[model samples]
Structures are given as structure tokens and as C-alpha cells.
Target: MGKPFTVSRETIVLAPPEAVRGLLDDFHAWRAWSPWEDLDPDMERTYSGPDSGVGARYAWDGNKRAGRGTMELTGVQPHRVDVAVAFEKPFPSRSRVEFVLTPQEGETHVEWFMRGELGLVQQAFALVKPMDELMGPDLERGLANLKAQAETEAGSVA
Candidate 1:
């Protein structure tokens, strides 16, 4: 058994919470900003359930670098969205992901969080690449991309 791990990244987007939430609440919008989307140009994706709310679901399968996983929106609020992710490729694992959006002065404070326990496979993988080392960069890059997307959309509309 491996220890529990949590990874979080935050950024201030020059947009309103609603604007940012629209991008995150809908998995389809992820194509505009999700860092991992570039991993495989041909990644196969499937969307099901409600269009983009609490029951929305997304599944993807691609090359080794892209891996395979399913994400489901479990909850959504004006300031928060929760996702349950199950990965099944290279390795099998599950994690809970959260996006917290807070409106400040005129922008939105977005925090991305993920938590999960490292199973035997991940425990061993940690010996070589700790959770933070493996996931931190991705989380950071994702936030940056999200920030740019939100700001760009907000700008075009203004």
C-alpha cells in the first residue's frame, strides 16, 4: 500500500467565475485548454450522460503517452466542480479532482486539486518518480492553459 497523495495548482484568471466554470463544467470545452489533449493528436474520446453538468462523462483512449481514462462530473456549483476519474491503462487507478473558482475583484481564482491513494503499482512508481514530480508539472501547465483560454474568451467577448 502506498501513502495518500494530493496535488493542487492555482491561478488567477482574468475572467469571471462563470466564464471559467463554463470551460470546466463541460468536458467538451476541455479540448480548448486541457494540457493532456496534446499528448495524442488522434486520441479517441467519447462523451455521454448530460451535456455538461453533474452527470456529464468523458472517456478517452490513446497512445501510451495518452493512456486511457474516464471522468465524470459528480457535483457542480457556482464556485466548485468535482470530478471522479478512473484511469485504466499502463496502470489502474482512481482519483478525485476538484476545481474551485472564486470571484475576486473582477477576476476568478481557480484552484485545481486532485487526491488519491497510491496503490502497489503507483507506490513502486513513486520510488522512481514521486507523485508531485510526476503530476505537478502537468497540473501547473493545465492551469496556465486554462487561464489563457478563459482570458482569451473573456477578451473576445469584451
Candidate 2:
């Protein structure tokens, strides 16, 4: 056991909340924007439960870099999505991830948040490379990719 921690990143996507939510609500659509999607080109993935929204599940196992993890969509609303994530390899940890979308003008403000308790191993690792240092870039990149994809799709539909 270790201390609790939170890491968050936000970006403005030039699209409506619904558009951004579409990409987030479906695990399959994550391939278009998820930062870790390319970590291991041959990563094995499985999807179960509903196609999207609450109850949807996505599991992945890959090379050392990709590790192994599972994500379940625990809750979904018009402007927010909550996911339960568990990593079993490379580390063993569980986190609550949230995506909050707020409409501003015609665009959407997207905030990605992750909060969890670090394991003893992770706490030690944090001393060398903090959680923010490790996850901030990935969060930023994912949000940037999400913004680009959402804007492109929104523009095409306009």
C-alpha cells in the first residue's frame, strides 16, 4: 500500500460534447486517439459487454512496453464518462479514470483525470519518476489526438 495520487490533463477540442463523447464512449473508437494504442502493434485486445457506454469492457495484453490491462466503462452521462482500470503486468494497480466534457461556445473542453493508490513498488518508482512525469505526456498526447480526430470528423459532418 502507498499514498493516493491524481494526474489530470485537459484540452479543448473544436467539436461539440456529443462528438467528443462518441469517441470516448466506445472502446473500439479509442484506437483513433489512445496514446498507448501504438505501444505494441501486435497487442492482443478483447472487447465484451456492450459496444459502448456503461458496462463496456476492453482488455489488452502485449509486449513488456504495452503490459496487460483491463478497462471497464462504469458510468456514462451526456458530459462525463467513468472508467475502472486495472493493470496486471509491469505493475499491479487499479485506478478510477474520468473524462469530463464541458461545452464552451461550439467547442468542448475535455478533462482527463486519473486517481489511484500507488502500490509499494509504484511508490518507490515514484521517487525516481513521479506519476505526473510518467502520465502527463501520455494524457496530453491522447487529448491532442482526440481533439484532432474529433475536429476532423465534426468538420466533415458540418
Candidate 3:
């Protein structure tokens, strides 16, 4: 046994909290902003449960970079969403995913965070360096993409 490992990352989207929350609540919407989706264009996706909110589950199977995993929405609120993801195939691990939205100057400050206990193999991989370092850039890019899409949508509506 070893200490549990965790990483947290956040970004501000130039849109209202409601708008940002709407985007995050819908699993299918992730394709618009998730950097990982670009890793496997041919990845297979499946969704079950509700269209959004708690009980919603989405699974993906793709190449090594995208891996294979299932994420289920565990909690949802006006400005936040929580999910649990279990990876399979290439590696196995479970992680808790969260999205927190706070209104700031008419824009939404979106913080995406994940935490989980690393299995022996994952722990060994982390020894290479801080996981946050590898994940932060991807998180930033995803947020940036979200911001772009949200702002574009807002502009179109206005």
C-alpha cells in the first residue's frame, strides 16, 4: 500500500456559469472540447442512462492514447458535476472527476479536477514525475477549447 495520489486543474471559460454547466452536463458535448477525442477519431462511443446529470454513463474505446474507459455521472447541481471513471484495457484505474463553476465578472470560472488512488502500476508510472505536469497542459487546452466554443455560441446568439 502507498499514499493516494491526486491532481487538480482549472480554467476559466468566457461564458456564463449556466452555459458552461450545460456544456459539461452533456457527455456528447465533450467531443467539441476534449483534447483526447482528437487522439482517436475512430473511437467507438456509447451512452446510457439519462441524457445528462446523475446516472448518465458514457463509455469509449479507442487506441492506446484514448484507451478504454467508462465514466458515470455521480452527482449534478446547478453549477457542478461529479463523475467516476474506470479505465480498462491498456491499464486499469478508477478516478473521480469533477467540474465546478463559479460566476466571475459575468464569466464562468470553470475548474476541472480529478483525484484517485493510483494502483501499483500507476504509482510506478507516477514515479517518472508529477502527474500534474503532464495533465495540466491537456486540461488547459480542453478549457481553452470550451471557452472558444462557448464564446462563439454566445456571440451567435447575441
Candidate 4:
């Protein structure tokens, strides 16, 4: 095992914190903003446990880039949602994902954070592209897409 990787990304969205939190609370809502959703057009997805909140779970098996993994929401807060992620195929690993929301005046500040130990395969890949370099773009893209979707959802409600 190599040094663990920690990647955190923050984005200001033109929506309420609760609204942004809602987006993270539901796995189904992720299809609208999750960066990996498009990685495999034929990805098989399964939703189990609660519909949303702490117990919500999502699993997917997809193409090479998509791989296979399962994520379960383990904690929930008015402004934070924590997820436990585990990969079974392509690589077997685990990670802790946290989404924090903060309301500013009228807009919401959103931060997506992930931390995990590097598996042997990941350690090798990290040599080619550091974790931040590899996952940062995806996180940024996901946040950007989330911002657009949250703002759009906010607009529709108004």
C-alpha cells in the first residue's frame, strides 16, 4: 500500500445548500450530474436500501473506464453527506466520500472530498498521474455539472 490519496473540490452553486444536499442524498439524482454516468453507455446500475439519505446505496458495473463499484451513504447532515465507496472489479478498494454544503447569502458553496488508500494497481497509476491530477478533473466536471443541474432545478422551482 502507498500513501493514501485525498482529493477535495469546491464549487459555488446558485442554489440553496439544502437543494444541493438533496442532490447528494439520492443516488438516482446522481445520473443528472455524476461524471462517471457517461463512462459506460451500457453500465448496469442497481439501487438498493433506502431511497435516499444515510442508508441509500448504489452499485454499478460498467466498461473498463467505468469499472465496478458500490457506494452507500453512511452519514447525513443538514449540510453534509458522507458516502462509503468500494470497488470490486478492475481493482478492489475502498474510499470515503464526503459532500459538504454551505449556504452563503443566497448561493450555496459545495465541496466534494474523497480519501482512500491506493491499491497496488492504483499505486502504479499514481506514478503516471498523481491522484489529484487524475481525479481532480473528474471532480471538477462533476461539480460543474451539479452546479448547472442544481441551478436549473432551483430556477424551475421559482
The lDDT ranking, best first, is: 2, 1, 4, 3
Q: After superposition, how far is residue 72 of candidate 3 from its true place, in Å?
A: 0.9
- Stronger candidate by lDDT (1 vs 2): 2
lDDT of 1 by residue, 12-118 (tens): 99899999999999999999999899999999999999989999999999999999999999999999999999999868899999999999998999999999999
Give all candidates' CA lDDT scores.
0.94, 0.95, 0.83, 0.93
For lDDT, the strongest prediction is 2
In the range 1-158, model 4's lDDT, one tens digit per residue, is 55788999999999999889889999999999999999999999999999999899999999999999999999999989999999998889899999989999989889999999997878888999999998899999999999999999989335
Judged by TM-score, which candidate is best?
Answer: 2
Whichever of 3 and 4 has more lDDT, that candidate is 4
The better candidate by lDDT, 1 or 3, is 1
lDDT of 3 by residue, 1-158 (tens): 54476666777667788888777888988889887889888999999999998898999999988999999999899889898989996788788888899998878888888788777776778889666876778888888888888877767334
Give candidate 2 regions above 4 Å deviation: 156-158
Candidates sorted on TM-score, descending: 2, 1, 4, 3
TM-score of 1: 0.96
